[model samples]
Target chain A: MSTRSPTPVFLDTLRHVETPEGIELSLRVAGPVARVLAWSMDSLIRYGALWVLLMVLAMLGEGGMGLWLIALFLTEWFYPALFEVYAGGATPGKKALGLKVIHANGTPVDWPGALIRNLLRAVDFLPLLYGFGLVAMLCNRNFQRLGDLAAGTMVIYRDPAAAMPQLPPGRALPPPFPLNTAEQQLLIDFAERSTTLNPERQAELADLLARQTGLYGVAGVERLCAHARWLAGEPT
Target chain B: MPLETIAAELRRRNAWEATDLGMVMVRQWLGSIYAAWFTVALPLFMLLHLVCWGHWWLAPWLMWWLKPLLDRPPLYILSYALFGDPPDRRQFWRALPGLLLRRQAFAALTWRRLDVARSFTLPVTQLEGLAGKVRRQRLRDLSYPSRGAAIWLTVVGLHLEIALDFALIALVWMLTPDFIALEFFDLLDDSSQWGQLWLNVVGFCGLSLVEPFYVAAGFTLYLNRRAWLEAWDLELGFRKMAARLAPAGRVAAGLAMLALGLGLLMIPLENFAAEAPSRSNPPPPAIEESLMNPLCEQRRVREVELAQAGSSIKQALAETLKEPELHVCQVQERWRWRDDNSTESPPRSPPDPRPGQWFAATIELLLWLAVGLFIAVAGWWLWRRTPRAFTRARQRAAQSGPRLVQGRNEITIPPDAGLGDTAWRLWTEGQPREALRLLYQGSLAGLAAQHGLPVRSSATEDDCLRLAVAQLANPELLGFLRRLTRAWQAIAYAHRIPDEADARSLCLEWPRHFAAAGALPA
Candidate 1:
């Protein structure tokens, strides 16, 4: 006898859901505050390093007015360039903030993204200091600047831990999945590491349980979700 | 298993694997890279400028430290060739920015021809060379994903853009008769502190002064490139032709985008800056004393006036004696006739003019800052304000209410309201309960409109919420809506949301509560 039954409740509307747009599924992630905290710490470290370097050079140049002038130029220009090229990040500040610059399709940062974002720092620093940049970041999705939009890249917090493992072992199941080894590995890896998935992701996955279990366009996706959760050793 | 099950399983397993320290280390390393970039470049830049200007003392010290920071192998060879020995502490202090980075230092050394030969240390790659490498590395980049070619090109573009603007101004300024006589090269040679500072200031001023012209040209070039790439001109032309033929909305959208871009570009100029500078080396002052040149004579007259204004009788006389006219040594009688004992304290030392000069420079810098900010802000505003074709679901949720509760995954329909879209129509006719489930994802606009709160497509969630709360007597609905808005904003704009029970509760209760509240409102 199944105790779970559909009933009207205030909480019902708040269930994790996926709305089908054309191609890519938009995720509404909730509750992974650790990522945010980590990002902030990372950004601080990076910025701190940058600030240290500047001070050292300033000290080295020993109040040479010319060297100081060059420092100003370097602060605005080559600083970003080095990160863009070598580290594939913004200045240590942006990177430590858990933000990685990526192309629109979630690819590695290209030169355009790096240059645009960095060059746009001039704009961000407009009207005195970082006023425009802050405003732009506040307004845009992924906290992008004009350079980001133009370059088709985003500054996103990436979880290296988010990379999934090879297929989950020891579960007897149906076989017509049409997945290659890499794909299998990717999915399995994703499942094993699922605890790191923010609550919003968990909900989204729960909602999509039907499709992953090959129950999409079939009789019952919700039931499949409950079944899969049980199979995966989660309480259902 | 259902698709949802697979997704959930994958997500669960992924969470378990997120504990990899390696990934964390990579992140930290990437962060370090950012730090290194910020920290290393300024010092490196100072070193580069100093070295180029032949500040050999500091070169060795900078090289010793810089080699470790960089990835390049050739830098060591180059540093060795330039410095003969690595820099020591003594050389480091001697070569600091104050001494090394100045153009005056460069000029002074260049005049003497005693400094080490300068070479471009950062290699200059051809477009083909750069692009070929980028293409080859594309796959690798995708696998590891780092900042690659696009960033370099953009940097080059920035330099080119600024360079082109400067070049144009220089071209224009060079054509003037007065500028032709200006001894720019001599000024460059004078390596004194004041001389170098003055020259740099002048260069900065020049950059600012020619900003308007550069902006116009740069903007035109940018637009032309955009047009060529997007065929926007053709689109506009076609729209114009169509509009002329029938006079409809066919032309409005494209025109709007063009106007929008123009508006964004122009906003910086309009809202922020009046003037900014173009940088260039200043020509040295003329040596020739000939009064034939009007500009030179004007300067001479101005100098005489300033000398008179700045001096007392004795000082005036001293200055006059220095001039070719009025020889005080030869004509001692003229000097003797002057009241030498009348010591009135030199005209109450006119407030040192340095502060005023500094103030003007600050204002100029501020203007540049303003313009830059306006461009960035306006551009961002435009980018975000324009509507995308697809609506984010989170946005809808935010608009509905605060505190979305989990459980309800379907839309619901009110029995009285028959109007529905196609999907709703099908669900209502075939599966009334399913239709009700579908209706769970209520449009905030629909809810507002049904309740008669002057809601429109243009209204923001705050706007709707305010009106709804004010009009409705139920605090429960208001609270729910408020929580929903928070989630919606977080989800739509931030791409994240807070996980609270209220979100699920609001989603579940919205249909019945909204319907009942609308029926019995304040």
Candidate 2:
């Protein structure tokens, strides 16, 4: 739906979606690397499950092979799609990786999209080892393969599990300029990342922002830090 | 007054870090790179694909990897645009080869995170021009934040490209209604060789559409990173404030300096008096009192006059030593190899470089970079111009007109065009000016040649009718020619569109009229 314009628009994986209730939600798209890692975890789990079930069913002798084929078909074809559609858009592996499948618009993944995307695994595995699928992912912006394209779906990172960072002891101050969503994000990010930065470097960055605040040198750095604290909603 | 002289050229000189918002940079340059992507790279890719044999997949896959090549163009173009020297279409074409996918083509494909890191790399590689250790340090400093957004850009861009690719294929499929029909669709398998190839081509086209944007977004992220690094927003804000306050600042400075000057002048001479000459000192030795007194220090106590018979003692003291005249000359000499560009010593020539020397060779590193960059540039040159290099094909294209196409349409005009031929040529070329000229010219030529109308080159449509309207008597031709003239005159002079249906209908009638005029075959 977004491809109407011949003028190419920059689409960030970071999607800011508004709910009907007017609450905003930000979602990050998972890249091929993370998705692949999650898929590997899922595959390993499936492999273990197959081994355990086969070992148990071996006691039943001749019937085990026939039953195992049914199990294999079900596990291989339906496992991911079923889990994704039913279990918050994640398979066991995706859950572990803190990833989930969603519609391009940041809505929950629907049954058809999951089924279609999962069904296209065969197509992805063409020639060998998800050959065309890997190419598609590498070539694409969102790291979506052929299936994801057809399905109009995306695999995004579930919001980070980490808690909001604590702003260091400082007098809180409002940012001089009205920050849009991106700027707001930048401030919050600065505060979060500042802990890792050395004092001089932190001060250096803060001083750079001094011009905007009409402050100079140390005062500017302190004020910017205060603004970051305020923006992050930290208690002074 | 400062900016007025070089207003368009004016830009705040900033460090690599002190740039504008990434989005601002991206917005400034988005359109240009987009234009270049489709206008420059797409057709080149298509031509490359056409020339490629058997290995049908090679072009598409190469296109996949070669997109990183485009990342540089946006950076180069953006680098220019940011500094207030945005390249025009022609300039961009000229500059495209040197900067296009210069060195990082293979690395772009091979690295796992290189796709994600491209935006970060643009600044490290291009903007800072940092190399070796310093470059690495800069990259490290820039990597985290840039890499985060870079990942996002890659991911979202990919998804967008995929969606777009799908849409393009769908659009193509929908364009041909017969392809959608059940019987025809069933007959033509999509998995077949040609079918898949066409589909891949469509996919490539779709990918091409979104790739420039992907590069643009990466560029934006990079710009943003640099902005973050340099505090560009603050710097720009400061620059703008300074510019605004400049007139007032100068006045304030002048006033302060004037106040200080006045304050200095108003001080009393007595308060700035010299030390007391007679500090309780009575007359002592002949010259002792004079040395101690301020009044005597500046004043002559006794005057010695020089007589004609005898020279003064001061002159006699100066004549005791002779003054030596000084002379200096700049000495320069050239040896055998002084005029040469070669780096050599004796018969052994240049000494063998040690492994440690290789690492420290900044000059050599730069030289190699240049060579690699040149080769890449040469590749792009060949890519864009290689087809034209074929003399045989150039002649064929001459009859067919410019083979450079925007879309699936291979429309061309004849190189050596005639009246009717020229109009068709112009129409095909999408050149309204030339097309319309030929259209009118062809119509006039038809009127004169077919009918016994006295149409001169200088004659107006009115004059033609007045001279031979009765002789011509064909109202359709007369009406057609008049309408053509009005349309032409409107576009040529007033720059207005005549009634669309009327012009189109006239254009449609052109062939028939030409045939009637015996200007063309029926």
Candidate 3:
């Protein structure tokens, strides 16, 4: 994954992790807003759970409050840690939001990391609410809280990808200039993404090369299409 | 799949947003064509579903939930139309079975958009031919920004739907007969009987009205994001330019034709060899060497300027220092027998004159001077270690994170009057920040002026705080200074206003702490 410093704040980055098997994995770190929503989900779950615990343990009278206190302590502290360490690095709330916690190295977070992050919530809570935590998150690229920073972990989306649509049918045409790998990739990129872009835009973009192509307007776009077709191994 | 989605974005990108006129154009182009087909299918699906399941609400949900499946033909239709390919409605039907058989079943069930990325979702998968982890990575990359757009677009669509629906209902109420209007209100009053029915009807209508723009927006975001990541704009521009450049095109064509022509000029090797069979070796040509020498230009000049070897920097430095004529002496404690053992002191033993003793004394004097300078430097370095070193030690005790510590260079502050009184006075005079600045500056100055603490000019407020906290002997004073620094930093940098009471208390409390900050070297 490219470290997206100096890139726009809006653009969420993909962390490219090469697994032990040598396969590259892209972990898309979730932003602050998404994490907040996930945290809300987890909190909601915790509320309902404690409510149930209160009703169920009502049977034991005075002793139940003691049990409830213990349960509350466990639920508040251990709930997130256990889920993060054991349940594939996510609480139910995070899972619902399609978020997972992982080490900065893209490995699964260990117990220490999970514990440190959760424990720091008290400190991260700061003078009022999660003031420090929020500031830390906004400043950090990965939306990491003080806990995540201390623990060396990041939260990312676990979304799967859909297959790409088939390329548009066209006859291949040879390019007018020699291209390196990056330039060649651009041609394929245009073809792949052209379906999502407007034709007027495609033409306008194609027109930018009047200085180089000598061809103006429609011819340039047509030429680009031909080059794209050729790049994709379509019929000449 | 949907070229208009890409086309629309190109339009939008070309002209930032003309009140979303491009969106209107795109919707007019793609939405009108697709919605007609969607409308035609809706009644038939409704009738069939009503007979099977007995709920008309299921039809629109089915229409929406089956959007991923439904989008395929329309995408093809839009793509073809954009490319000027012949439109074939029959092809849409023909491809239906293939789409059903091959497409991701789970993607059709992306009920909520959060799951949109999780469902192996969208035109990216269908269009890009990537599968498994690679596709997943792309989807993961696109999800955040796309979801953001999707959310905004959905809101817009819903608002548009509400406006349109409200206008339609109002127009109907105004134009239609009075009896129907009364009946509609009566039906609304009986919410239990007609509530779910009205909800389904309104919801479906709203959804149908919004779905086109929503889908278009989503597709545009997805495609545009890919374009951005892949730099499609640059590539297409270059390819088009390169086409006109003809870097290898017409020349290669000409070369191909030339090669064909050259083939006709080839001789039959066997026949040529037999016709001219007589072989002879030629003698070597005689070599003639020329004896002429090349002419060269030359210029005459006076003697080159040079410095005398003895006149160097070393001698100059010696001359500048001006070595002083000095003598060294050795004094020994000498005991002499006192005859009377009286209080009268005997004459102090003086060094006896010895040859070459003056030279030895000079060398020894130089050695002593060197030792004195070293001692001074060592004392200064030791003195420089203050509270800042302690703060660093405390912070870096065990697993001290290797932070790129900012501002290591210390600054020298001019110790003004009393640090505490000056800070308190400045703070009370409504210059709170300046007050804190004075306190920090005074404390630093006190460190240097009183205790010989070395300070670099580059040190920030934080550096001063850490240094003060680590160096100060008293805990109460240290804590007080820490709070003062924290408050000052908040106000100075973050623009936070400390509570008047807090500020007042701190102002009053600072001098006491400032007094304690005057640490002396051990």
Candidate 4:
């Protein structure tokens, strides 16, 4: 009798757990650098948009005073308020940052959370600039600033697309059984250079296996043929 | 089942609607409407300021009334784009829930919250306390990633609109017959020539303004349509239904929130707008006017220089304080507090400082201390009690796993195990992924097992092998294992599954050779 370790079972369970109870998201872990870059880009775009607008407006008025005045007001209140109420972000900056305002249980961000986070932007600002905020992020696990702590919100990255690797050619091996063209090709191609094989040795071995595996062989690489035919039993 | 059924299922399993463009558009329109509204309010505010300053005569002549209406066209366009033809306020309100629950949108919100949280000088203790609350799932909803994205989108929209508005005003000034006449009409006194020139300039400016607006409106409409098609409304309706059917307390809370929202909406209209006259009398200061003007004109240049210098100093100070030395501190204190002279010191216990007095005193003492006895003892104590440290340790422990050799091209399979056991073990040891790769290529018993639907209890090696060869549409794996077919034939016919060692060896060797099992010529 053999006892099974529950580790695989747990991991399998975790994989299938797209969403936890009461939450609406599939639980997928992402790389930290990717998450940070996505967020930074989002913020830059949003704040940059506002800044550009202000610059244009300023260019229009007497020495751009009107634009500057509006920009100042916007940096403080307008950015967050408009996003929170309509798009549920501080501004396009926050939104682009791949961040959202939500309730504690993964619901839409309420007005209080929005207000608290925006208001605490002053505290997160700290001794000089967002230095305090940076420190907070460094110290905290989720990289939350003071405003985020107050607001109870977080920043996370979204999913990207997927791709697969192609197989290499193989060496000649004796065929063990009958084989189809596709199966023969698959075996010949894949077993060409096992990771264990040295680069210099790979081509020589692959040619040998290919001949035996039915790619170019006599007795038609019986072992290779047999393996290819048996392997066909599994899904592609 | 037909291939269509399989394809449909696969598509559904893999599908996720792209929401980026839609989110971007909605945020842009929201920003536009808000910015336009703000613009309209500016002149009104200015007029109100002048009225309080007893410059009431200037208000009417300055065309303050037109300020509010200036934003109308943009607002109308935005409203139409967001809500569609024959826009309904009720439907808009109803759709709010759906919009709120959107997955991508919600992800953006969480990102926004994390960005916001980084700004404060929150003591490590307090921050940890908050983090505890957050990680406990108490604060999950409040921290969505998409909040940041949506906000930034709005910011962009606002900027675009502001630029448009500025261009509008500049165009307006440039096109006015009076201004044109003042600047150029004198140069060419012919009325028809002046009119024609003015018409051409106006036409050009009109085209510029109309293009951005149309683009913006179209973008917003596209996003709204996409959002609608995603069935966000249905999702929200289901959630609402679930909440309604839940316990009475949740139902009551939901109702209360609705009532509160309704009341809040009414408060501003009822209180402020109704008493407009009283409010109008005591207007806010002339912020824009003063901001635009140089106070005490004689010293304007000197003042500007001084202000610029001051701002630079402020910026420098802000930047300096943001440096890491101010916040990040390493923990390396060993004191007699936890088993004196012990190589691995036990966790420290925090000092019981006198209430309300420790803040300034401890900060200074801690900053000044350098391996001093008192500080060491205190630091060790503090480290022990620090929730941050505890949380870090806990997390580290949770993530502990078998150490795999890093940067290796080849994975080593464990020896001495049955095939199934080996696969399971490899998976636990971070090699299951490699095994899965093998499985993807082709596995003899696995394919046969899938096809034959063998009895769970009676899966002899022979039975598995026969199924692999006879039942499977494809038998690459069985062919690969044909070297052992003679041996397996006896086991299957004899009604006996291979014992632990044979199975284990097969499992171990399988992944190393699995890739070659399913290759096909292009």
Candidate 2: list runs displaced more than 4 Å.
Answer: A1-17, A28-62, A102-155, A170-214, A226-236, B1-71, B74-88, B100-123, B143-522
Per-candidate iRMS values, in order, are 27.7, 12.5, 17.6, 26.2
Which runs of model 1 end up more than 4 angstroms from their true locations? A1-65, A89-91, A105-113, A159-171, A175-236, B1-522
Estimate, for each residue in B161-265, the C-alpha lDDT of model 4 and write its tens digit. Answer: 334333444444556686344543332232554443443333333333332333333333323332233322222332333344334654555665654654443
lDDT of 2 at B187: 29
Model 1, position A2: C-alpha lDDT score? 12
- Ranking, lDDT, top scorer first: 2, 3, 4, 1
Return the TM-score for each candidate structure. Answer: 0.22, 0.40, 0.32, 0.21
Alpha-carbon lDDT of model 3 = 0.56
Query: Which lDDT values do the candidates have, in the order given?
Result: 0.39, 0.59, 0.56, 0.40
Predicted candidate 2 versus true structure: per-residue lDDT over A79-158, tens digit per residue: 99999999999999999867899987778898899999999988776534564675576566566789999998988777
**True contacts recovered per prediction:** 0.00, 0.01, 0.04, 0.00
- Model 3: CA > 4 A from native: A1-28, A59-68, A172-181, A209-223, A229-236, B1-522
Worst 10 residues of 3 chain B by lDDT: B296-305
Deviation of model 1 at B362, angstroms: 59
For model 2, how does the per-residue alpha-carbon lDDT over B1-522 read when each residue is reduced to its tens digit?
A: 112211111221111111113333344355775666666566767776787666566777667666666566666665555454556777777767755554444455576334465655766665566566787787788776557656655664576566555555444454566645643343234566576577567667767655654555465556566555654444443344444434455565465555455344334323323433333434335433345543333221111111111657534422321122211111122255556855344463565778669767977899999999999999989877875667655455433322321123333332222445556455556666556665665554455445545444345656755665667677877777777777777777787756656655666677767654332312
**DockQ for all candidate structures vs. native:** 0.01, 0.02, 0.04, 0.01
lDDT of 3 by residue, B1-522 (tens): 322223332321211121122234234354444553474446645664566464644555665565555555444444444334424556555755655446554544543333433212456655565667896787777665555545544444455555444443443445667656454354334244254455545555654554544444455555556556545556444545455444566675465455454343232333433444222322112211111111100000000000112656534433322223311111223465667454455576775777469879999999999999999999888767777776666545322211212233232333334555666677778787776666565555555545444444556767766776676687776677677678777887898867777777775665554455434211
Tell me which of candidates 2 and 3 scores higher on TM-score: 2
Worst 10 residues of 4 chain A by lDDT: A8-17
- Give per-residue CA lDDT, model 4, range A140-196, as digits (tens): 434456777778864433334443323332333334333335434545333321333
DockQ of 3: 0.04
